[model samples]
Target chain A: MNISSHRRTRDRVVTVLTYAAMVFVLLLPFALFVGLAVKSDLLFREHSLGDLLFSSVWRPSSGEFGFKPFIVGSVYVTLLAMLISCPICLLSAIHITQYAPTRVAKVVTTAIDILAGIPSVVYGVWGMVGVVPFVGKIAGWCGIQSNGYSILAGGIVLSIMVVPFILNILMEIYRTIPRELTEVSLSLGATRWETIRDVLNRKALPGILAAFGFGFARAFGETMAVLMVVGNVVKIPEGLFDPGYPLPALIANSFGELGSIPEIESALMFAALILLVVVLIFNATLRWLIIKAERY
Target chain B: MESNMNQGKEGRNIERPFAEGESIIRVDGLNLHAGKTHILKNINVEIPKNKLTVILGPSGCGKTTLLKCMNRLTDLTPDIKVSGNIYIGEQPVFGSKTDIVALRRKMGLLSQRPFPLPMNIYNNIAYGLKLRGKYTRAELNELVEYYLRQVNLWDEVKDRLRSPAVRLSIGQQQRLCLARGLAVNPDIILADEPTSALDPVSSEAIEKQFAALSKDYTLVMVTHVLRQARRIADYVIFMYLGEVIEMRPAQEFFDDPREEQTKKYLAGAFN
Candidate 1:
């Protein structure tokens, strides 16, 4: 047997093995999710799919299950978190790339990287201990008497945890701008501030929007930190101070008790399916936006 | 302080071209250092007003650095130390109280490669005028058209002023950059090999525009091409190894040729 043919056979075996492994890893979770959802739907066919998706009655004892409140809670907290994190991340990125001294920028970049690596449970503990009381005080000043655990607290905690992720991405995008472009603007009698506002920001708009999408998707799916802070009341919040339960929080809190009520388990599986669908949509949109940015 | 440094030069006859028609830019005893590498050493010359002056040198010999220094664009580079007395018109460029924005407004620069603002064709030209002061929509429109016309880009792009400037060809983008620079109405135009990236026809178009523009503005260009220097330069400064080796009228410098390095460079020995 020739050595070349022996090596070729070995290479073919390795390539086939890698492809099989990749396909298995990609499909395992999706198969499990669909199988569990179908099983739950067949086992408990009392509540219709609409009732499981849109109705807010979530009492498991009387056999009523709905996920509307969790869906709304997830959207509200995520949007508020995005609203808080986007400007802070963008401005900090701009300052680091354009205004701050090199040494200071390096220090800030290191601090942000450290923040990105911190565990979610640590953020939850910090939010429970530190930010919850601060939010309660601010709410009290606004003449709304409330406990500290609320949607605002949860959103604030989520924003703090995810800021470094968005900041690092945006800073990397801003740094890709060519030095010649800025110099050309400045040489045209533009002040430094004008150059940044008119030239740098305009050029990086699409990438900035993409960063926002990434932050939103991450915030929407966050589980542990939000679960600790948000009072899991399972209702649509009327104000920032009102307590609410998001989908991920509900799933995390109720999964251990699934054996008691089969219908609750089915409903929770459906919620997970919803989350999967929403995340898929977000990722698709993000990919399309990045391609659009590069095209022009 | 300025004259004393030049007078101490041991044996070189530094050509004083300051006797020509009203000198617009004068550099005396300019020395530039980039992190211990002496980039430009004791440079002295006068660029006359309303004439095309070419700073002729090979690559890395400090011609581009000198052009950038005139507008303080070298301040963008890190660890650069510049010591010199440079005057544009009557204003001191390196003085402590100089307003760099206003100083830059008096000069227009065309780089080697074209980079139009990441905007539409109309906005690229309108942005600079808007930064200067308020202008009515009609006034700005007329001004944009006038400037584009001056660069001969109006006929090609007049129909698609709102389209993104990056959609244009490389040659058109270069011309748009020229229009954008001229929209600010600068007194002097500094070009760092504006035609180096261009095809022959596009390069000829730019050279023709520069010749016409020299009647109204002081034009200073840097080029390593001996043919380009001879074709367009009214006054020429020949530099080699970070020092000015010769400064003379273009006709005399090309025909009679004073320095040995300039002669070798002109004979196509090596860049």
Candidate 2:
């Protein structure tokens, strides 16, 4: 009886510790949001939210701060990266899971894991050396003047960086589907490609969307690689060849000089808050979608 | 008993006559190896057209493996070597020039568990039909209804055609899978323990459907249940440890066994 009581006491303590850990994790994002909001209150009090968001001017000396260009840059570069990455990732994942031999698929997945583990700064360096020049050549062929560092260059690099993330999720989705489903389709006269296109792809659609959401969030908040190739020009880009500055780039570039300038710290804090909120919203929506998909 | 069984294995050629009806599928000297383990050893059998041919054996005896080889479904397994000649009608199964898709289209398969395509009930039936050729919406509707009725599922599902196929009970899902397979218009139907995952009622329903379907399609089934085999199998092929122990008409094989293994199996000596 005494030993059983002691064991019960230990179990209760462990349960309490687990709940405490979960609560701490659950509150971290809320704490970060509140801290950011409080710091940005100085800028919010001076400028209306709409003016701060929509105005295009960014003269810190005269106290004119606008986030429209950076917002557009983040959206444009992230969308460009997704457009470049989605089809390649989807097809590669299908091939690896459905067609490639076991040994070959294992090798390919290992390569993807290494790619995922590479440092972001290394990707930035590679982008400067390779992607910028390729984009410059493409711009020249298209009769546009570009100095190699532009949104297109950033997009190419960012797309390559997120390929592993998207492909990993897609491959996992395909693998979870029962082997029986594939055989049933095959025995019904469907080719391998037909089975993937009709049955497997349809089943994995929600997971594909969730993968794109994750890739989008990763590309949107990427700091070093996008900052390196995007040229960090504070203007709304007219086209793929034009220079632009995303929100993360703006905060990274100006964070060191924050105390010397009045209200600048608040503005940067506001930018961080915006990035956090957008990523949170996207992730929440994807979670809701996955749950709904599973229900049916 | 062991020596008698060895003699039965040695004298396989003289024990049973070839299937009396027109043979739809013939396997000659079929051998399969997965990695280093030999899964099927020198199988020779014939499936009669428009008959219920049940491959009976204990678990892990390659009954399902032999059934899968008929439709070339075994090709999906990795690191497996299949060296054999299988003929369906006049077409060689593994011939270099054979169209695998077309060959598979001629054979429908029912797995141990129901696997409905991830789609609405209507689309699940329509999927195979769409693969074959373009059909008008009216024609697709009529054909889907006809196949569903063939499995006796039309009345139960007529009102919920647009609902997801997975919403049905386990029994209904198996029937839906049957309808989906039949939609491809296969001449041969292969079932690998199709009722193993079902309750007794559902198993009975599926058995009734199989019995009815045998009048039109050449049905090959794998089952370990002796009672079920006795009830449904017009022809029987008994396998043990990757070898065909006996092949004969179901009545004769059950009533008068030629081999000690067959007699022992019939008397419930061992699974």
Q: Give the winner by lDDT.
A: 2
- Model 1 chain A lowest lDDT segment of ten: A36-45
Docking class of 1: medium
Runs in model 1 lying further than 4 Å from the true structure: A1-50, A283-296, B1-15, B18-21, B267-271
True lDDT of residue A25, candidate 1? 100
lDDT at B166, model 1: 93
For each candidate, the DockQ is: 0.56, 0.66
- Estimated TM-score for each candidate: 0.88, 0.94
- Candidate 2 accuracy as lDDT: 0.89
- Total clashing pairs for each candidate: 0, 0
Candidate 2 residue lDDT tens string, A1-296? 36798899999999999999999999999999999999999998889999999999998878989999999999899999999999999999999998888999999999999999999999999999999998999999999999889999989999999999999999999999999999988988889988999888888888888999999999999999999999999999999999889999999999887645659988999999999999999899989887766633
lDDT of 1: 0.86
